[model samples]
Structures are given as structure tokens and as C-alpha cells.
Target: MPHKRRVYFISDRTGLTVEALGSSLITQFDIVEFQRITLPFIDTVDKAREALAEVNQAHIDTGQRPLVFSSIVDDAVRAEINKANGLVLDVFERFIVPLESELGQKSLHLLGKSHSAGNVKDYNHRIEAINYTLSHDDGVTHRALDEADIILVGVSRSGKTPTCLYMAMQFGIKAANYPLIPEDLEANRIPPSLLPHKAKVWGLSITPDRLHQIRKERRPDSTYAALDNCRYEVAAAEKLMRQTGIPFLDSTTKSIEEIATHMLHEAHLVRRVY
Candidate 1:
């Protein structure tokens, strides 16, 4: 049996960065199991000491040193956390020094810099894009298709809605998604509402088996969720996309992030947010 090590991600704000970095590093050591804990908003000395106590307790319980990944910017708080009976890896301590040296300047050591709302314009854009995506989901309305940066078209449950929302939230892209219904599939053509913005359209395809499984979870034993219906829908949708020369991608094996990123690259759309 593999020994499970305790892992902590402590941050001055939301511990997203530390968690992302820690998870990435931990995955490289496949032989070891990890029990993850996140301690966010540890900006004060008292909070830091509390976090240290938790880390020490984990170490005592496990009879092994826990791994601590900290992103605290305050020197005093960071020092307090370093006193824990575990291995402390501070992200800012490791990289900020090199960045300061390279830039020949001191770092601001600011908190909440990673996901700050300091850029009002960018923040507003992201909010607007998210609202737009929500309103336009599943071909609910084609009223504002002209304002969309990208339009995703695919058969039902082909991973379109999530991909659209991800692009909107992560990249500040105005994304709209439309489902290709059986009527449009039978006609072997694109939707009339999307025809005006055909250049902004991208298609997503998934294997019929995968689609069948997904639909079955929503409506088991129904004709809509039947394997044969999934096969026909996918085949017709793919054929229509091919006949129209629309660029498409398979969503079966790709994550929503990968799909949105590839769509951005293929469409040559610039991301408004990082």
C-alpha cells in the first residue's frame, strides 16, 4: 500500500494558484498518495499560526512530514507559516526573487494579484460575456449572434454549453452555442440564424457511444437517448458540417479547456483575459 502524505496549499487569498501548482507537481510523483488541504485567506499572522498548527497536527497524525505549498505575500505571515513541522514551499519566495533580479526592481508583493478585480474593463467584459453565454445557450435566442466572438454548433450533449461558458469566463470571449436539431440535420445544412455569422461558427462532434451514454443518464430507455438515434444524429451532423466546409473538432477525448483553446487558435480569436 502507498503511504498517503498530507499536502497543504496556504494562500493570502483564494488558494487557486497554490492548489494548481501543487496538484501539478504531486501528479509527477505517481507512487505517492496525497491527502490535499487548502487554507485560503491566511493573510494575518494569527491565521498563519493557525495554519501552522494544522500542518503540525497533520504531521503528528501521519508520523511523516506534510508538504506545504504557500503563496503568502506578507513576510511576517510567511515566516510564521514556515515554523510548522513540515516542508514549506513558498511560491512567491521562490520566483519573486528571480523576477526582481531579472527586472532590476522590487516586487509589489501584492495580495489577490492572480485573480484581482483591479482591471475594471476586463472584469466587466468577462461578466458580460458570461451573461451573454447563459442567455444564448442551447439556441435559446439568436438575437445577439452578431456580437458573438464565436458560435459553437453541435448535436445535443456534445459538450457545447460548458465549452461556451468556459471560453466566456476564462478568456472573456462572447460565446454562443446552438444545438443542431434533427430537422436541421435532415436538411443537411447550417441553421438559418447562424448563416449570417457562418465564419464565426465551429462544430463539435462526439462518438455516438459516448453521446448515447451521456443522453441515457438524462432520459434512460427513451428514443431520444437510444444508441441508434445518437448514431444517426452524430453521423448527420458530421456530414452536414463536412458538406458546408465548417471547421469541427471531436469533443469525446478533449476537455472543455482544450476544446475552447483549440477553437480560439483555429478561429484566430484574441483572448481578452488571461
Candidate 2:
């Protein structure tokens, strides 16, 4: 096994940009393993310095040099992090220097403004409601599967978990997922647990080749993750879904947003929020 690499992303808030950059880097290195640590909302110089020190200690303890990806907006705060002893890639420093020269104007300050005071209360209320729903989420509750807003049934790795999470998180939907195991496949049946929920049931299908690639990344040696087995399972699962009169969405090419939106619209379910 190749030695794993640790990557840290420090940001004023959310760290979304740095996360995107880290994801892009991972795609370029097929066989390397990368671990990500996000230090969000490190707005002050002291906080930024502390984060850098933590990364430095981690590198020394592990004996592996980690990469630092950062999007610190404040130059004074960024200066504190530059003292670290690893490869550091600051998004603002890297882009701002070249961009300032290109644009011929000082870059505008862009940070610390997420939501306004007038909307913050409403936003917080909605966040609270969503968190409550997720904790009390009835999606996985047994004996109540029939009441699911959307019931997803498919073979493992057919994008069931992520789809369900997206539906729940994005729309406040109570989405449930049931995996179609080998026994279910061999018997040519949807699970008895989901039979009563057939009206609300929806299938998620993936291209076998894509499924193979996803599974191989997760578990490289298993026959269950091999291409031939993936093809067999996907085909059988699709046939069973069709025979059982369950409508399905192919998830191979669509983003999670698109898939969830299609299901909501097609099923006539009203979306509570984005």
C-alpha cells in the first residue's frame, strides 16, 4: 500500500473553495490516498497560527509531509500560517497576486457576509427545523416504511444513501433506502419490507461500469465489486424493478440535485425548501 497523504484546508469560513480544490487534486492522483481536515472560520491571526501549528505537529508525528490548502482572506491572518513546515497552497495568495496584476485594480474584500440580520433568524429557524427532522427522521423506522415520502430500493452502491441524504437535507423529505442484496436478486423480488410501500417506492439505477469503478475504489479486492458481478446485479435489479411496477431514476449521469428534483417533481411531492 502507498503511504497515505494528509491534506489540510484552512479558511475563514465553510472552506468550500479549498475543499473543491482538494477534490480536483485527488482526481489527478489515482493511486494515492488523501485525508482531508478542514479548519473553518479561522478568521483571526491567532486562530490561523494555531491551525498551522496543529498541522505541523501532525506532520511531525506521522513522519509524512502534508499539503496545506487555504483560502484565508485576511493577509495578516494568512501571514501567521506561512510559518508552517509543509507544502502550503494558499488560494487567495496564489490567485490574488496574479489576478491583481491582470485586473490592474486591488482585489475587493470578500468575506464574513453569509446572511443578513433580517434573514438570519429565519435561516437559523429553518436550520433548526432541518436538524430536528434529521434526528427524528422517520425514513429508516421499521413498520412505518409505508409512509415514506420516497422509498428508494436498489442494489448496494446504486446511490441510495447519498440520494436519500440529499432528499432529506435539501427538501426536508423523509427518504428511505433499502438495499437489494444477492438473495433478493436471486429470488427476483423486492423485499417484503418494501412491498406495502410500492406506491412511494422509486428505484435508483447506475451504469454497471460506473458502479464497478465506485465499488473498486471502496473495496478493491472483492468479487462483489468486480465489473462482471456489477453488470449482473445491475441488470437483475433493473428487471425486478420493471416487473414490480416501480418507477426509477437512472443516477449514473445526474447530480444528486437533479435526481432529487426529478423524483420530487415526478412523484408530485412538494419541496419545502432548497
Q: Which candidate wins on lDDT?
A: 1
Give me candidate 1's TM-score against the actual structure: 0.95
For every model shown, the clashing-pair count is 0, 0
For TM-score, the strongest prediction is 1
User: Candidate 2: what lDDT?
Assistant: 0.81
Give candidate 1 misplaced runs (Cα > 4 Å).
1-3
Local distance difference test, each candidate: 0.93, 0.81
Candidate 1 residue lDDT tens string, 7-84: 999999989889999999999999888999999999999999889999999988888899999998999999999998
Candidate 2 per-residue C-alpha lDDT over 1-274 given as tens digits, one digit per residue, 9 for 90 to 100: 5446788888897887788887788679888677788999989988987898898987886678888888888888888887778788898898888999999999875786543334765567456534543543323445555446878888888877777777776676777778888898999999887777789889989999999999999999899899999999999999999999989889999988789889889999977643
Candidate 1 has which clashing residue pairs, if any?
none
Each candidate: RMSD: 1.6, 7.8
